[model samples]
Target: MTMAYKNVIHGLQKDEGTKENLFALVFEQGMSTNAASIKLAIPRSTAYSWVKKEKEQRSAAIEASEIARQTAQAAAAENLKVNLFALVFEQGMSTNAAAFGLGIPPSTAYSWINKEKERRDFTGEASSKTAREISKEDLKENLFAMVFDQGLSTNASAIQLGMPPSTAYNWIKKEKERRDITGEASSKTAQEISKDDLKKNLFALVFEQGMSTNASAIQLGMPPSTAYNWINQERERQSVTAEVTKETVQETVKETLKDNAEETVHETAREISKETSVETSVETSVESEEASTKDADSVYRVTFKL
Candidate 1:
């Protein structure tokens, strides 16, 4: 019968949820069309159509009662944003607390603060960085204090300091390496072992005791890859020493065998020469005896003839 009814006839139809929500706001909560529209993030015309449908079945007193309340809420929110901006920028009050005190959402307050910063910077009234922005040095100092004094983890400290976990981890690593912090162990072991000692133990385990490099490393609380590297280096060194010693032993054995062979040949030649000399002396003595016998026979014959 009214203009609202006319609008409802041509209005786009919404889903059941939207219709139920509109019914609750308009009838149950007694909110006006404009207020319900703002709260529901819908168009005022659409809310008016929904309200028209409600009005055909309900009374006008509810809408009138909620109009003043909705107007007041709209005005208060606008003023609250202004106050929140001033509190955050001029009075140094945190946006979160200011928003909570004024009954504004924290996310909306943060958005307003960012808008204010942008406006101020555009007008050349604000510096490049906001007063709330923390410097790298201050952040690092706070992170260090949180980790050392409060006993927070690097990740937790970084989160509190508004930094990435990786950045915090890298900074801590650099500091530990630079300061030679012995308290921090790579593994879960309470005691820290020196590299030389680690290498020695690894060598004894793998080479002497025939343990696998990975198992030895795990036993010593070292990384398996690191153990593998150390083992390879030690094996190379041993191999070089073994080659040198083997060559030396071979040369010594060769010289000893050569000396023994030469001495044996000289002694064999002397024995052969002594046997030949004995044979020649016996032959000469036999020849001399035969010649003497011949001379005795000739003397006997000449004496008998005279």
Candidate 2:
């Protein structure tokens, strides 16, 4: 019916090998009809017709391949999401940092974090019915067990135990503080060093030792948040102190310059007055000598006349 169909029939009659080659190129190799036409030196219309028929024959296989490709892509994306989530929640990485590290978009990573939190809240609410009434001490013990033994995040453990995340965090903080006070904490920095010594160490580590905030925090056995807060406050205090010191130094310099300027002006005025007095005295002496000489001349003239 079509020129391509006619070409196919001719090919079949002339040589089956040519027809097979066309099928192999268009079907097995997945070459486009136009491309196959050039490769096989066949007519474009013949190639199109052969490719169309081959597509119909292999439609199921093509559909299956596409589905497989989509599934694989979806699986890879899910794996990436899981890894990023773990990095943020389990490993204490910030969402943006984790996203950047994993080459994920920050907005997408934030959405995932929100979804996970929502899921956790829903699960916590659903399981609240089975939540047992326990003493504060028992709850604290369980929280510690979940965190230390099972390696669960504080938020995750709080959700499992049907407690608010803030409450869990506060309880943990208090416990740590109590342990530190009793010298039972494992951190040598916290247990052995006094508060003043700890502050000095933190300052030296960051400013004098030229360490990063995180590294300083680690060396001081303090939470990064706490370390950052201390560093920020210290910087603010130092900034204020520096401003005060600069003002004081500037004032001192001004005072010193002012005194020197005043003393120089006084000395200049005294020198000018001394010079004026010396000139006045010399002029008076010269006038007195001239008057005496005239009187003597008059006296001599009078004597001569006598």
Candidate 3:
């Protein structure tokens, strides 16, 4: 008999007005259409079409869920970006600093700022900054001064101020792009010299050569405040090195003293032992000589009496 007939004999087939085994076999049992069709006594085409429809439905459901998850993530990310921009634009935080505070990368922060700037520029949106934004303006002015007056590269300036390199580079680049449409060459250094040389010189003059901060600042042609700031930061870095060296030196001195003390004690003990040994040997030799002389005298006396 056919498997369909066997299925009917075994009561696997549903009676009239009951749930059909064709769908049950494919859906619940995960059977292939050919197996389900044979087992449920149904046409192969019917089983194939049902399975295809179920597969498409599941695929559409999965796609919809994924889109919803992405939408939620985007919304959350937008909120974070708003806070990041507020820090950069209003509070004068560097883009990298803001990004770090928000647990993001420097490049992502730079990209977001650039995109925002482009959007604002395209729309001609001149957002007014509060009084707090003076710092940002000051930063821009100082960066430009470094670029135009000091002949320093944006990278060097950024390093000097502990700001992100990309932020400074892009700021200078954008300013140059704006002025390119107008016209004037900024005096940025061609060789991109590291302004850190100034710091090194300042430190050498003050810490190494015993010069005062004022004298170092004068010699370096840097402002007194800048000199102090740089020197103070350097001092913090060197403080750790000094502390470790101090501990190492203390331990070395202690070990040397202990070794020297032990050697001195051992030498003193050896000298004392040698002196005691020599004194004891001399006394034994003198006592033996005295005893031999007495015995010789007594033997002569006894011979004469006999």
In candidate 1, list every pair of residues with a backbone clash.
none
* Residue 221 displacement (Å), model 1: 3.1
lDDT values, one for every candidate: 0.75, 0.77, 0.78
Q: Give lDDT tens digits, candidate 2, residues 69-151.
A: 99998998899888986775555555666787788898988999889768867878424432222344567788877654454
TM-scores for the candidates: 0.38, 0.40, 0.37
Worst 10 residues of 2 by lDDT: 125-134
Best by TM-score: 2
Would you list the clashing residue pairs of candidate 2? none
Model 2 residue 225 lDDT score: 75
Please give the distance, in angstroms, between residue 256's alpha carbon in candidate 3 and its true position after superposition: 35
The TM-score-based order of candidates, best leading, equals 2, 1, 3
When superposed on Cα atoms, how far off is each prediction in RMSD?
Answer: 14.9, 15.8, 22.3
Arrange candidates by lDDT, descending. Answer: 3, 2, 1
For candidate 3, the 10 contiguous residues with the lowest summed lDDT are 12-21
Candidate that would win on lDDT: 3
lDDT for 39 (candidate 1): 86
**Residue-wise C-alpha lDDT for candidate 1, range 1-306, written one tens digit per residue:** 899986776563544567778779888998887888898888889778877877775666677668888999889878997788766665555566668777888899889888878888899877655544444556667776665444445765665555557888987777667546665445533123345556888899998999999899879766577788889988899999999999999999999999999989998999999989998898888888888888888889899998
